[model samples]
Target: MMQINSNPILAFLVTLIFISIPLSALAAKHNNATEKLSLNQDDIHGLWIEKRKKKLAVWIEDCGNALCGRIYWMKKPLDKKGQPKLDPHNPDTKLRNRPRCGMKILSGFVKNKENHWQEGKIYNPNNGSTYSSKIELSKSGILKVRGFIGLSLFGKTLKWERPEQKLQHCG
Candidate 1:
């Protein structure tokens, strides 16, 4: 008859190694998911259009130490009078005559620790309303723009996509 030698210390060590292997694998998987969410901040610098309403194209670019976005083009730049659309809803009557196509609707977007553009403002020409905004680039290559009244919970997120073809900027 053969007798098997049993060591408590060896058994415990083997058990711990087996447990740690799965835990380490789980951690690696989590890290990879996090890496996919962490995108380059510079990737935001380009033209993006609203996914739902393709009426406007906003061009995001480096402005000073932060980022700013301007209205690069419009599907219908002219008003019924055949004149360039103006900001009639602007609070300042004197500034209402300004064209909407070249307006800077997004400003002061600073990249934060979470790889999102935060502490920015987005202007809505439709109502001449400015809201606190933040932007995030999703893993699916969608530019998510959130405009909030006060806090983020009271906000709406709009998806903007990078156009595959060339755009007629301001044309």
Candidate 2:
């Protein structure tokens, strides 16, 4: 057997290589993970109906921190009696007070687990109630949204389907 001298330089090089390999791999894996959640503007654009409400349209978009959703359109502006008024004792006035055409009903949604997103709020225009909300994207392009009083078990779930694209006419 031949005697081999262990050099500090070789040991340092080996340690550096080992650390770099895993670091680079981790970076690549992170990139791939983010790519999987790549959401396009069109994917969330258009009208979305609130399952609880008969005819309400909430539009989803990308907020500064995470994804945001708002009420961009509605079937009617006034109540059945044709009066433009808001409920005085409503708890979700911040969301439902504005005109239906431009209301931010959802905000601060962060991706959770795999297909679900948490840390968001959903506001109900009917009763003016805002609750903690979670959103899940299904394979069929349907968004399952849950808004609860305290926990998810105590609230209601709404499923909104992606609406058909419409042509914009500017006259």
Please give the lDDT score at residue 35 for candidate 2. 45
TM-score to true structure, per model: 0.74, 0.60
Model 1 lDDT per residue over 29-147, tens place: 88965654443233788789888989888999999999999999898999999999989998889979999988999999999955488999999999999999999987677899999
How many clashes does the backbone of model 1 have?
A: 0
Error of 2 at 151 (Å): 2.1
Worst 10 residues of 1 by lDDT: 33-42
Write down the RMSD of candidate 2 (Cα, Å). Answer: 14.7
RMSD to the true structure for each prediction, in A, is: 12.7, 14.7
Cα lDDT tens digits, model 2, 1-171, are 422236777777778999999999999988965544343212554456655554666777788878887665555656677765344436645534545446677988888776678999976656667799998877766778889878789987888864444422111
Q: What is the lDDT of residue 113 in candidate 1?
A: 55
Error of 1 at 46 (Å): 1.0
TM-score of 2: 0.60
Clashing pairs in 1: none
lDDT of 1: 0.86
